[model samples]
Target: MNNYLIKTENISKRYPIRKQNARPDTLVGTVIDFLYKPVRNLKELRNLSSAQNSDYELESYIWALNKINLKIKNNEKIGIIGKNGSGKSTLLKILSRITKPTNGTAIIKGRVASLIEVGTGFHQELSGRENVYLNGSILGMSKSEIDQKYDEIIAFSGVAKFIDTPIKRYSSGMRVRLAFSVAAHLEPEILIIDEVLAVGDASFQKKCLGKMDDVAKSGRTVLFVSHNLESIISLCDRVIWIDDGEIKGDGNPLQIVNQYLETINNISESQIDLTSINRDTNSSFQFSKLIMMNQNNIKSSSFNVGDDLIIKLKYSLKDQNLLKSNLQVKISIHNSTQTEVLNLNNEVSGYIHKLINKEGHVVCKIPHIPLGEGIYSINIEAIINSGAADVINNVGSFEIIPGDYFGTGVPNNTKANFYCISEWE
Candidate 1:
């Protein structure tokens, strides 16, 4: 009566690295270098290659996954979140059986469809139409089954025009669209997707999310990894936060996302170094620092209710043409629970409509900080007139202390989001 579809018992994965610079890969170069280099180095290389590949001590290795244990039930929609190199993709690769673990075991009970990369199961020499049948066969689907879904897949992918052409000529976006359409339609018991969907256009990404929603609704297990918190919150029932190749937190999507956001607060003494943040989005400008100021004009991360709060973001343009471009700044404020409490944008505020220079700052001021006594974080984004230029989530955080917002010794409505300045009848 066990419903668990996936189980990993202390699963770990390690990758070896060269003790020094990597040895030359060309056969001729390797032989020449061995003859020219010191004999001691050659002996070391021989010993390194002789040991078992699983042996962790033979050479320096990175533990991509460390003692990870998980049990996922059928039909569960799980979201995975982490900073770059935090092993989110590694875990997905292990679960998909593309990579083996180093120290533990994973037990999977059903068919898996993984869209981890473009052209994952495709052959470059094969036509798109042939690759569809080949990929379906590899997924254990019958030819008849693939034929039944073939038109739908091609239609969804919008690649029907090139179905008979070799996939080597397909662009990355086209390949991903076709791959995702096939994987989602193949009726696999479990589906795994990485952030490669970010390569698609906005409309296609939306289509993929909608298709994933349908997949989850059809009583299949799904493991998704993405930096889009809003999409994760909408599609995932549970979330796991990974840090340094270890599970930092796992539970409710909202709560775990909040926990992950807290750690992204690199701001100190009211200044955040944006270069230290790991962002996945592209941009024509890079952030330099984020500074918060109180009404007294002192930089601080703590403010009292009803006090004026000022946030300033400094950035440098990567392209000089962007200076003349119509750009805007958008900021979102989230409560400690990761629920967005406020969203502000330059277009709405009538503040920064365009850039005046290649390097400068944007300022946002709230005359009265209207928030209950609690901690909150800030998410900042720079957008061109066309699309997003840069996005930095949870870049800064601030705390609000209790204050007499009602202009009396006793404050009004202390439990809600903010106090209401009212005189009761």
Candidate 2:
């Protein structure tokens, strides 16, 4: 018997970009071209007719996966980490047999299941109950097997009341819940998951993470992908870092995660450039920049505990809306674990009335930074007419370091998360 359940040898996938041409001068020309086009286009026919067949000359291919080689042993839990468009999902798709590799081979020796996206294998018109069996059949399970797991799946999803409801009527969160429940309960030999967990609420996210931890402990092979590095560290024993369609590093989770965070920090600019960001089409206002200013009003990204920190948000409105009456600005602070630590909004603070310009600025002044030593993220929300005009997540991250806030030189205990001012009896 082979010890490795999954093996890839120089696996590569290339997607071809169809030649884009401008629209024809007339509708008749477009219709004629569409209806009378050759089965093989002229360029392809010419290439095939030529004996030399200079196929390498074509530059219309994007390499989504590049020479990905791995020997995943049976029952070894793995976490895949990468930035957006880094080909993490592409690799998972290849492993899940959703797509074929253009080059090389990948051998799998067990049943595979995946939750790559919401409603991935579901029919929107079908009821949730019907989709459960449909998905089970698609996973190659027999009717008897589906019957055995049906109750467990429905119970875990917490949508038992709506089990007979059409999936199209379900919200995005509900769809994710059912999809994840089915994928997790079906008991496949290999389970592949993507970042779809981000769709769930905080409690559900924690529950799903715990279930994944349980699944890994059951001695099954699991390949998980997420941007939450804290969860990755907690769940995975081994981590694989993918970047630009290639594996950059693969080893211990802590070491790889630390290295990846360092790379991200190095690539990050000193300050965020918000003006270049494209606003959503429905946005009534758009954010420009988020600046961190010290007590002296100098811009910076680092601050010490107990230091007064000012967060300045600059934005522009689409029309002349009174800032004091029509606009609401909200700011949320989140730790590296992606947990919200604090939130502030104009509705609660009553400070937007101070602004008097179309180009608006809201400054949040903290008498003393309450957070301990760690990196924190800022999320900005702009609301107009009771609707979200603009929102940004993880826009700018700053670091809080230890300082002599108290008379004693000893640093405050970061584990406890706060420094208490007390009197010695």
Best by lDDT: 1
lDDT by residue (1-425, candidate 1, tens digit) is: 77799999998876543332223447886698678767756755665544325653554445668889999998899999987667899999999988777778889999887877655569988999998888877766799999999999899999999999999999978887887777768688998889766778899989988988998999999999988888899999999998768999899999999878767643346877897676544445777889999888899998888888999889887666565566688889877645578898888877655666878888889878888887888889887745556777777788888876655666554677876556679
List of clashing residue pairs for candidate 2: none
TM-score of each: 0.58, 0.59
User: Taking the tens digit of each residue's C-alpha lDDT, what string does model 2 give over 110-177?
Assistant: 98888787556799999999998888777667889889989998999999999999999998788878
lDDT of each: 0.79, 0.76
CA deviation > 4 Å runs, candidate 1: 20-56, 121-125, 168-172, 269-425
The per-residue C-alpha lDDT of model 1 at residue 118 equals 52
